[model samples]
Target: MTEFRVLIVDDDFHVARVHSTYVDAIPGFTALSPVGTAALALQAVHALRPDLVLLDLYLPDTPGLELLRSLDLDTIMLTAAADPESVRAALRRGALGYLIKPFAADGLETVLRGYARYRRLLETPGTLDQAGLDRARRALLGAREPNALGRTRSGTETAVLETLASGGLLSAAEVAALVGVSRATAQRYLAALADEGSVEIQLRYGATGRPEHRYGLRD
Candidate 1:
C-alpha cells in the first residue's frame, strides 16, 4: 500500500504536535514537522510536497481560508471555525473534507482512509463501473450513513456497539473484559467500527512504547 505524507498546519504548537501524533498512529499515513504559520506551511508544501494538509482556520500570519485558496494542494480543514461562511468557503475552495477541531483520532482517521480509498480508485488502470465511480466520488467528498456492524459474525458485533454506546472510552482490553471476548477479538471489532465510521479511535501517547488506542462511539 502507498503511504500518504501529511503536513499539519496549525498556530498552536502543542495542537500541531497532537495532530501530528494522531496522523502517525494511523496506518498508511505519516506526517512531517508541523508548521505554525501560513508562510511556513507554503514553504513546507513547496519543499516536501506532502500528499495532504491538515489545515486550521486561524493562523498568526493570515486567515487559514485565504491560505487554502492560495494553495493548489489537497487539504482537510481541521479547525475550530464552524460558522456557515467558513463551511461554505471551505467547500468552495475545494477542501477534501471538513473536520471540526477537538475531534477524536478516529474522526480524522476515517477521513484519511476515505481519501486514500478515493485516490486508489482514481489511480486504478481502467474505466470504472457505475458502482466504482459512485464509491470513489463518495470516498473523497462524503458518504451516507455507514453500514452497521450487525451483519458481522454472530451477535458479538451488537454487543460491541452496545458497549461503546453505553458511554465513556474503552480500550480493546477493557471492552473485551466487559463484552466477554478476547482482547484481540475486541480490537478487531473496534477497528471495524472505525472503518465503518461508527466509532472513533484515539491514541493515548505514553512516555514510552507505542500509543494505546481508545475507542469511542462517533456522534
Candidate 2:
C-alpha cells in the first residue's frame, strides 16, 4: 500500500487530538494538520489535499454539510450528532463515510482498513464489463456501514429520533408526545440525539413562547 495521509477536523481539541493520534499511529499513514474549525479544515484540505479527511459535521463557523459540498476531497464525517437526516444529507453531499462520536479507535481503524483496501483495489487495473458494473452498483449501497453499527446507550434518544424522522421536524413538545415520553425526557433525547449525529437541533422562529428549538432530521 502507498502512503496514506489524513486530516482530522473537529471543534473539540481533545477529540481532534485523540483522533489524530489514532490515525497517525496506524502504520504507513501520515497525518497532516488536525484542525479545529471549519475554515481551518477547508484550508488544510485545499493546501495539503490529503488523501482522506476525518470531518466533523458541526463546526464553530460553518454548517458542516455545506463544507462537504464545496470540497473535492474524499471525506468521512466523524461526529457526535446522529440525526438521520444529517446522515442522509452528508451522504448526498458526497461524504465517503460517517462515524458517530464516542467511537473507539477500533471503529476508526476498521474504517481506515476498508478505505485503504478500497483505495488499493481502485488503483488496480480493471476492465469494466456489464457484470462488473452491475456488481459495483450492488456494492455501493452497502458500503457506508462500518464493520458494525456502534451501539447507542440511550433508548429514549433513539425513539425521539424515530419520531423526528417520522414528522420531518417537530417541536420539543411534539417530540415528547410522539415518543410517549415526558417533556424532560424528550429534551434529554434531543440533546443526546444532537450529540449522536442522528438529529439536528434548530431554532424555529416566530414561535408563541420560548423560541422553540425544533428537532429536525439532520440534512
Candidate 3:
C-alpha cells in the first residue's frame, strides 16, 4: 500500500511532536518532520510533496490563512482559533477540515481517516454517478454513521476480530492484510474495538524510532 504522507505545521514544537506521533500511529499514514513557520512550510511543501498538511492559524512569520491561500496542497487547519470569521475564512480558502487544538487523538484520527476515504473515492477510475459523488462528498465532510461502542459490528469489523482471535498480537497493517482491507480501514476498526475494551494494545519498543502498536483480543 502507498503510504499517505502528512506535514504538520505548528509553531509549538511540543504540539507538532504530538500531532506527528498521532499521524504515525495511524496505519497507512506517515508524518514528515514538522515546520514552525510559513516560509519553512512553503519550502517543505516544495521539497517533500506531502499528501496532506495539518496547519495552524497563527505563525510568527505569517498568518496561517495567508499561507493557506498560497498553498495548493490539501490542508486541514489544526489550531486554537475558534472565531467564526477564522473558521469561515478557512472554509472559504478550501481547507479540507478544521480541528480545534487540545483535541483528543481520536478527533484527529477521524478527520485523517475521512480524508483518506475521500481521496480513495475520488481518485478511482471512471466518472462518478450521483450516489458515488454523494458518497465522496460525505467522506470529505467527515460524516460518519454512529456506531454504538462495539455493541454492533459490521462484517469487516467482525472479520478483524476473528483475525485477531487466530493470529495473536498483530499490527494494524498485518490485520489489514489478513482481512483484505486497507491499512487505514483496519486501524479504524481496531481503534474502535480498543476503545470498547474488546481488544488490547501492546507497545513494542525497538532499538530506534517510536514503539510499534500491536493489538490482540483482550483476555
TM-score of each: 0.65, 0.60, 0.70
- Tens-digit lDDT track of model 1 for 20-81: 99999886689999999999999999999999999999999999999999889889999999
Ten-residue stretch with the least lDDT total in model 2? 139-148
Best by lDDT: 3
Specify the highest-TM-score model's number: 3
- How does candidate 2 score on lDDT? 0.72
Model 1: lDDT to the true structure: 0.84
For candidate 3, lDDT tens digit of each residue in 1-219?
Answer: 236899999999999999999999876689999999999999999999999999999899999999999999899999999999999999999898999988998889778767876776677679989876776677677664345333577899999999999957899999999999999999988876654446666676699978788989866
lDDT tens digits, residue span 125-181, model 2:
676666434433333322422212476446675676667767566887888887898
- TM-score computed on alpha carbons, candidate 1: 0.65
For all candidates in order, the CA lDDT equals 0.84, 0.72, 0.85
The list of candidate 1 runs beyond 4 A from truth reads 141-219
RMSD of 3: 6.5
Clashing pairs in 3: none
Name the 10 consecutive residues with the lowest summed lDDT in model 1.
144-153
Off by over 4 Å in 2: 129-219
Off by over 4 Å in 3: 145-219
Q: Rank by lDDT, descending?
A: 3, 1, 2
